[model samples]
Target: MIRLVTLQSGIAQGLLWAILTIGVYITYRILDFADLTIEGTFPLGAAVTVVLINSGMNPFLATAVAMLAGPLAGLSTGILNTVFKIPGILSGILSMIALYSVNIRIMSDKATVAIAGNSIKKIVATLFPAGTVSNTLSTTVGIIVCAALIATLYWFFGTETGCAIRATGNNSKMSRSMGINTDMMTIIGLMLSNAIVALSGSLIAQFDYGSALVNMGQGTIVIGLASVIIGEVILIHKEHNFAYRLFSVVFGAIVYRTIISVVLTISGFKATDIKIITAIIVAIALSIPVFKEKAAMRKKRNLAMKEGK
Candidate 1:
């Protein structure tokens, strides 16, 4: 049944993944690297957070610890790429493969770790003391985290270091010529990206999934890329502002999840078909610019023909 609850859950899930999209945006867009490490980083965050929560650590502190753990993976990728002279994509891939084992270790060699009983204090619980695992509570937690993330990112990107990172992404050679340590910028950007990816995983474990599964983050990189592409399509004037683009990415994630939810409800789409749907969505979104260019060319051709006639 396509109930209101379903829509709310979709929105909430979108919000959580929006954080992941932002993390991906930093590495893919800002650092100009396809960081596959994020695929493993997400689940690592969830596994670490869940384990800490089960061990009776404060949820906020547990989340922080998990967030910090993300940078270690990023650092490994960075070292491989920068120091060992590995290609960016291959370095990220190697780190991601290694993280699967690391995530397993974090989960105590378990495939899944469930957050335990009433003794656990998660962020959503702290936000709504009286409420059960309702859509409203989940949505609130998502909103709070998303808002804080956006504001912090916006401010950070305006700083000198952030500008250097962007410059590195835009033109590494030019940035190097300009006396910026492009290598450091790339490492910092990756670290920042994976940190947020980890944060999203932690919140998902606590707020949405209520359990940490090793394979839960599979195919997440594509989802993040699709979300970013959808946002670019929605915002026609993407050059106007950085903040707007970030906001659009969040909107894109929500819209994509809502569409999926509706499809699942109305068409009886299998849960396993989600990857196929995501692939279709990305293909369509990516083709929009080419379609627009073709239309403009056709219009100009007709106008030129009429003037010649």
Candidate 2:
């Protein structure tokens, strides 16, 4: 049996990352854009939250401000891509690079900003009787928050504006022909995506680490991509409803974290090997569908030859 504390921690971490992965899913899978600005926006959220909390602001309010900061980052990328006519990938890269400096400025040029008061985990602990497991409470909070977010996204994506955005992603030329403002839809999608990513960063900083580090968001995009791919691979045959897809993304994050925990528990496995392992897992997940298709083609060809014989 998996250890209770370890399981709780893994679930909490997975839930936090699930939020980020959902954001990635919007841009990568929904909008069909490889927006790399998430790498900057994630840390930007953490920086904003830590700065506000250290200034004696309420944690919840600080998190809200952090979420707001995310849209601005996304808008910057949108303007670069839509207004300035830069390529989608390039626009995201430019925005991400600029946000690195912005994040440092937000932290007053400090590489790390620590929260001065009780961490969010401690605050949640107060809600339970003394001696109750903090990880369990935090994980519960994460689950509730994630469920709310997924529900909101599911509803939003079903609306007229949401359909327009989906159409924009599916085919920009077709969307434009249908009188949809494809550029505007793209901007809105990016803004919403980065906002969610920032929100996740803020929550993770407050509830888990109580500190915002400049490099904390490095490799975040990779993890997000990995989660998205893993979820798609696992749920390939399931109904593709928006809510189900969103839930699958969250589940994927949980599975990814659990795998990492299990790997760490193995003898001779070091923490430094995590990125390489994650990359391998992502590569394998991504290749599965291609391999399956190739095998199917070969099988069809063999059947045709046997029938001809």
Candidate 3:
């Protein structure tokens, strides 16, 4: 019974974290750049939302405001990367380092701030009520929000500018030759990616943890990359469909969470072993493609030898 509950909780957590993974996908996969600002943006969104809510702002409006907070951070990275010619990863690191102090200020210089007041703390808490299984509501909300974002992204990415952004990621030089402004595309992509990432921070802070902690986003990049890699492994053949890829990312998070939950429940692995588990999962998932390619090459060599014989 406890295992069942744990599994259910894992699924819920996966659903929530999937938003962050999708956000990571925009820059990591879509734009083909590294942006570490998400580590700060995640908790930044949370801090902004919680502070605003505690100050008597409407939860919905406060959350919306938090969503906007991410793009500014992205914009900073964009300017640093595109204008100053700093590397993408370094630009992101600078923004992330700066956001740490910003987030601390937003949280009123506190380490953590708990959700307060009579307003709905969790986004879907009203639907679940106090005593019901929290996982069900979380799953439902996750499905709704993720599906909506995916659908919206599908339509947006099919447009001319979206195609240009995708092209820029594919080959910036070719995109430049084709008269697309690669720098602007990178900026837009970074902005869009961080926007989604910040929203995830807001939602996760409000929906799951019920508090905004300074270190909530610690090592988030690994988890996001892990989820993306896991999803790609399972849906390796669906690379052509953007929507399908996004769905895979969402599913990957769930699978990642489920694996962790199962291991902790059945094995002697403590909760603290999660980071190592994540690292192992990511490493194994990453090697799958290499392994496949080697196997294919060996098979081809064998066939060639047979023919020669």
User: Highest lDDT: which candidate?
Assistant: 2
Q: Looking at model 1, which ten-residue stretch has the lowest summed lDDT?
A: 117-126
The top-ranked prediction according to TM-score is 2
Q: lDDT by residue for model 3 over 89-125, one digit each (tens)?
A: 9999999999999999999889999989433445466
List runs of model 1 lying over 4 Å from the truth.
1-3, 117-123, 126-133, 236-238, 304-309
Compared to the true structure, candidate 3 yields what TM-score? Answer: 0.93
- Cα-lDDT of candidate 3: 0.88
Q: TM-scores across all candidates?
A: 0.93, 0.95, 0.93
**Candidate 2 global lDDT:** 0.89
lDDT of 2 by residue, 1-309 (tens): 567666667787888889999999999999999999999999999999999988888888888999999999999999999999999999999999999999999999999998886556667788889997656775787798889999999999999999999999999998999999999999999999999999989988877777998888888888998988887778758567899999889988888887887788778999988899899998898888799999999999999999999
Candidate 1 has what TM-score?
A: 0.93
Whole-structure CA lDDT of model 1? 0.87
Worst 10 residues of 3 by lDDT: 117-126
In candidate 2, which residue ranges exceed 4 Å CA deviation? 1-4
Cα lDDT listed for each candidate: 0.87, 0.89, 0.88
What candidate 3 gets wrong by more than 4 Å, as runs, is: 118-123, 128-130, 298-309
